[model samples]
Target: MEDTGIKIQPTMYGIFFEDINFAADGGLYAEMIKNRSFEFTLPKTGWLEPNSDRHSYNKESGILSIIKYSEEGANHNFARVEVNNDEGYVLINEGFRGMGVKEGAQYDFSVKAAKRSGDIQKIKLQVIDSLDNVLGATSITPDSDSWKTYESSFGVTKTEMKAKVKITFEGEGEIGLDMISLFPQDTWKGRKKGLRKDLVQLLDDMNPGFLRFPGGCIVEGRTLAGRYQWKKTVGDIENRESLINRWNTEFAHRPTPDYYQSFGIGFFEYFQLSEDMGAEPLPILGCGIACQFNTGELVPMDELDPYVQDALDLIEFANGDTSTAWGQVRAAMGHPESFNMKYIGIGNEQWGPAYIERYKVFEKAIKAKYPEIIIVSGSGPFPEGDYFEYGWEQLKQMNAEIVDEHYYKPPVWFREHADRYDSYDRNGPKVFAGEYAAQTMAIASPKNKNNWNAALSEAAFMTGLERNADVVYLSSYAPLMAHAEGWQWTPDMIWFNNLESFGTPNYQVQKMYATNSGTDLLKITEDGEKIIGKDGLYASAVKDVNTNELIIKVVNTLEIAQKLSISTEGSNSQQGNVGVLTMAMDNLEAENSFEQPMKISPKEGSATINEGRLEVEIPAQAFSIYKIKG
Candidate 1:
């Protein structure tokens, strides 16, 4: 029997916003220790103190104490040296006890000391490099006992240095020091500008259709109170919202190590960013009020109304007009016209029965007022029955517009099961691969070089998604950007910093798919003997309606090169030129760093057609798109 021709349909290639949140959190501490030094008063209590001067650290005490006072400049003082955890370390002018410094550098520091009698003393500061050489020194005199700050600058070589303050005893009297700070001549500060120009151009170049904002886990934390609060994030950069990050494993601190977050770049910023990028905004609202930090708990429905209302108000603000109250407020805020948001997601990865019930509530309320809008519900794994399946079942019963499917698995699994939705019921709700990433431990680790297997697997999966595009509407890669220093997850689509960014090999594959893939499914078949595997060479072909062009996407999964013979049996024009775009790299883990970004970029070549058949060799561990004019 003759084989059946393959079909292709419209598919979405996009990115999840979670990885951007990663950059906001552990990636870059985000406005925490700006310019290196900050000043604060030491509380009398709620601070911990160490017994020895060698070990000065904070545990959890209520007060700060300055101990170890020496008269006439004694090198050591035992009982007089007091310490407090909240107030941080104190400066005792005894022989200039100092803190560790960066290597190959010099620094100058000074402090103002206040005594119990309300008297003040100006103290000189000095720094020593790693070689114990005195690099810089400066003096400061306080006007009053009331808290004062002294300033000075010193130079250090391109090596490590330490900072210390010394009291030159002109007259014999002990001085008390509090609220002292030191500044390095140079510090590795974070990116001052919002987004890099090159990155902005790259984002613009992609011409993404839509943008998913905020985050995955960043939306909600272990508790209902900890969830992302959109209201707190809007307006005024200085007064923007903040929260503790929960994604990075490195944040495993003891005794509730407080990692405060500043929500400077919040919902308003996202809206503005989307507008600037010329992409539609798809915001995810929290469905489950209760959150799980180390453990899970449920929030009462009555108490959850506020959060629900917040979501409603947000939608209104985005889509409403000046005629309405919130809409007017939104206009005053910036955008007078409606943001025209047609899609809004309920919760993220809420895979429980309770979530289904909660989603139903959102669906009913949202649809009641805005029936034209598309409500996307989270659907779990395949074959149905999991929380996602249950959610979809509920959505189907309630008549949902779209259902989201998330998958993160081994590349090999994706390659083998690329046609996951091949037999899916199309009459049911539309499908969106809301979050999918092909990650393997071997390719993701920093220790390994670039691996093309992951990229190939993802490309093969894209081929399947493209072929099954009738049912699979939209898809995106999760954890898109991972900053090297603050990465909690691995194998991200792109890694960037203030100065530079680069797309992964897998990312390039998706980009090519998005840029070149066709919108219509074409009918094509291969000889049984020509098929390499059970599924043969992964392929999808589409004909563009406007340009009258036929695009064929093909992936050779075999280890050895495959020569493919192509022919358009149904078309009148049997012969056509073939434009090939291929992604091939020497090392699989071969990544493009900030220094060298185009190391693994795709290359283009062409092949000639003869009679009605064209033969081409496709390399293994590679992805290629063969385009033929219709």
Candidate 2:
């Protein structure tokens, strides 16, 4: 039998699990609201007509039109109108409802207009109350013969009784107006902050070394056309690109939102964010077609050059210097120094033989130019001889740098398999659990409700990942954020409204595990009593090389609190102080709400080490980290 008192040195090959996919989508879900959709347009004439799409309006030539009658107009019998091109000028008419306007309450005028011929002339906009008093006004000409657009800004004084929009055309040219919308200005702007700053700080505290973007199912589009395209998101804020977010429907659990996304937060923004957070950039680019399997039918190898070129161009854009053409363009956009991204993933979840062909093309080209860069390939599904196994075999032939894996299961499944890769081959390509989450069949369940027992299961699974850190290179929770009103999927880590944000119990658990663990794996054993008496107390240990500090992570998933007596050997009493960081809740289903963000948080306390033995008490339904000076 192994000696219980023998001490083992921690195996230190850098143990923090990374490669957690932690990026938010740049879709309309995050960026645009109802007021921002470009569907609304106003013509030069005809009565305001509602188009099939909710936000747009239609008008014929030569007459002024009002699509949205002012809400104030019902009370005071007046309405305002707004019009603009896509790029710059917004013409507001404040006197349309016979001039007199309400005081103290302001009416907003807005429109969607496009330039048809010469630039718009004296595109004047004004806001006047029912009393013919001009409250505010603004105007501008457009820059293109193309459909350049703009939105005007003006407000009626609160003291004014009522107000409406008025438009005057000085130029003799035809212009189109889809809709001229009017409402309270405040109503149109909505709220600016969606996520809570504290939650963001909590994630930052984990000190992740790298963040894998965008998604699991997010990367896998529902249709070929909806896949994530990096090129679509870049440049100045307004001029940045956009796309239809595929995950929106899943989160919304309904028909997808009608509006397309403006990918303002694209690859460049992700790189910038990583830099800001002191983490390395790991960019995953699309390969060939999105989420569809080819059924082993190959696209003729010669025709795949465009896919290969995209990979090359993306790398160049990320790492090239200002002296180059694309680099110069990137500099002109904003960043002068190359972002120097070192990890590039080719494709997402490609699981067929055709994927091998596709990957081969990208592999040869990328390695030839940037041999130092690590290449990651998606391996989908493995049951010994599944498609994922085939993908892994191909990677082996190609000497792939990393293998990306993803999973989404019920909480119970996670608990049973959290330590799944504990026996994984250590010499193989690094394993990256790109995306994972505990999803329940039931919708509308509260975030804290462990409806499917996911929280406990995931905690157990994470213990395995941490214990086998040498092989499990990275991991992250999937579907990180879901806007409460706009959710497309469920069982997310955080949910937010315009004013506040809250973390789920599972999220708090993950935070506790991530923050308290160290980057070194320690070996430990349990007596028969330790195993038989308590089944939920999963534990792992690590020693910090620099500080010579010993950190032990203990998760007690029982319904009642437990007292732990921890002992160590080959260490002196003169090392340092012992402390315990505990994350516990009174109930298993306890959660944090927007109004009470700290309802479920970590608490710290001191631990006593008497004669090289440390003893601490852990709360019920909780996880704790005990740190002892070496």
Candidate 3:
């Protein structure tokens, strides 16, 4: 290992979270009731009244109508039900593709209700299976004429994956309901209405360096009016307002019209989560421009104050003292201490002159107000050509701190571009390899799979990223997760369903890199040159001062085993037994599934060093990490 004296940034290996697929409302947020507030474009998108035909509102047990409290305000709509007969007047919620409940687990149920007319005494909430068998049941009695929240909990007797919540009203009468919510009692940290336990545990296990949230193209919506606004995603969950998810129609292959952002897990939760996981909070915001791939809508240059102001307010919200306005808002939500956010991104994959113009305004405003806060700019979507060149040149001239770059290419591209950043300007704006993934098929194609080929290639490419840790401050895999049954994009790092989740081979690669991310960068070369896919081998080395150990990552992408002898340079300390963690697969198409999550998981082994040199045989298509203590 050649000592380079370069310090690796602590924020190097991070996770990029975009609410694509059924990630949030369905997958992560732990909210089992869909369209809880009745605010979707179609108010009853996830609700069904089997006995009553909506076309004629014909005679049935009950007829439900959506009522708007006001033309304005976040929580505008609620369900008003008129019950004719109490026998079968039932309302069922099809949770994000059905809820997953476990036996012996307590499920919490809550709703805001008020009796509008005759004797509606009790509300019964039941967790029922596909055959309509009740798995768990709870009831709440509403004793108030005014809107008040009623809550109850019950333990399920049977574990069911495709469970649906059934609501029945006792005694025929008129009633109003809003914010009908259900969550597993056993959530992450045991907080009520918190994130999914299993899903979050997977993320925490990685020890990610940072969490980039609430986004992808969602930050820049299809139109300016629909762009993600941080202010709307905080405070009371009841008032957090839902917006139609941009991924609802982003891909034609996977049309999810019911997808929307409930914001149950909003900005405050993001900061809290980052704090919980010891990851830096990296929030990327819109720059008054819509998604260029869509409408490319722009908010008039003169009216970009609100956009610029959002950036400044976000900094205050994250770092300001309790006495400040935005900080006070944050404190009201239960956190008084600052979140200590250090990075703010201006835009997401935006490009051209319009993005630069808006970014300039945000940069100027942010630096003037909070100079210590690092601003992360964008260089459009393309990794090369005129757009990249122009954006880089402009940001470099403006002295932009970090520029986020995204790439979703084939496995071959990943192997070929292992040294993509080797020649980056030493004096220019630093890079945030913000979003990247090895696509097994075409980019954004529905046919892609998270197989060993893609992951192996990514491991090979990441060597360059680690080697150039000085210029690349942060790196994270894009579209971090996907719902196996409801994904718009393909080849995600992690995939999940209603009942279970499994890390793909790509996820294993990321975990290996992130968990062993060292403190100091060291050069690992062959014949006086960096190993960028030499003999189907790629490697990088680093020293972890905190652990008092040297870590070397090597990837072998061949059909047969290869032997490597790595020698320590300029050190007389004799090496002892070297620990090894290896993840290998002979088949490129091999992948991990819910049935076998550890199909490609790391296996621990050992090697020995002779005369300050460590010799190891790396299996074909394997990613290995060798650790030697000084």
Task: Name the regions of candidate 2 deviating beyond 4 angstroms.
Answer: 1-203, 237-239, 248-252, 293-300, 381-385, 442-453, 528-534, 546-548, 572-576
- Candidate 1 stretches with Cα past 4 Å from truth are 1-11, 19-21, 25-193, 249-260, 291-294, 381-385, 442-450, 527-536, 571-576, 586-596, 610-612
Task: Kindly list the per-residue Cα lDDT of model 2 for residues 1-630, writing each as its tens digit.
Answer: 112232221211111111111123211123212323232222221122122223445422232333442233111111222223322323333211123333453434444455565445645555555554567655655444444445555555543423434344445454555334443333211412122234355456555566666544445455545666666566544444345556444443344343234454567766665665566677776666455632222346787787677778877887889887667767876798888787888877767777777788889998898888888788874323588778877787776777888776656666666557766666778777776766664433334343214665566667666776776666666556655554555567776553345667667667766555564666654773322114677776766656667777777778788888777765453334688777676665555676776676667788678877777777776767878877
* Top-lDDT structure, candidate number: 3
**Global CA lDDT computed for model 2:** 0.55
**Winner of 1 and 2 under lDDT:** 1
Model 3 C-alpha lDDT per residue in residues 54-83, reported as the tens digit of each score? 777475788989999997889999999988
Task: Specify the poorest-scoring 10-residue window by lDDT in model 3.
Answer: 566-575
Q: What is the C-alpha RMSD, rounded to one decimal, of candidate 3?
A: 1.0
- TM-score list, all predictions: 0.71, 0.72, 0.99
After best superposition, candidate 2 residue 157: deviation in angstroms? 13
In terms of lDDT, model 3 sits at 0.91
Put the candidates in TM-score order, highest first.
Answer: 3, 2, 1
* Most accurate candidate by TM-score: 3
Residue pairs of candidate 3 with colliding backbone atoms: none
In Å, residue 561's CA in model 1 sits off its true spot by: 1.2
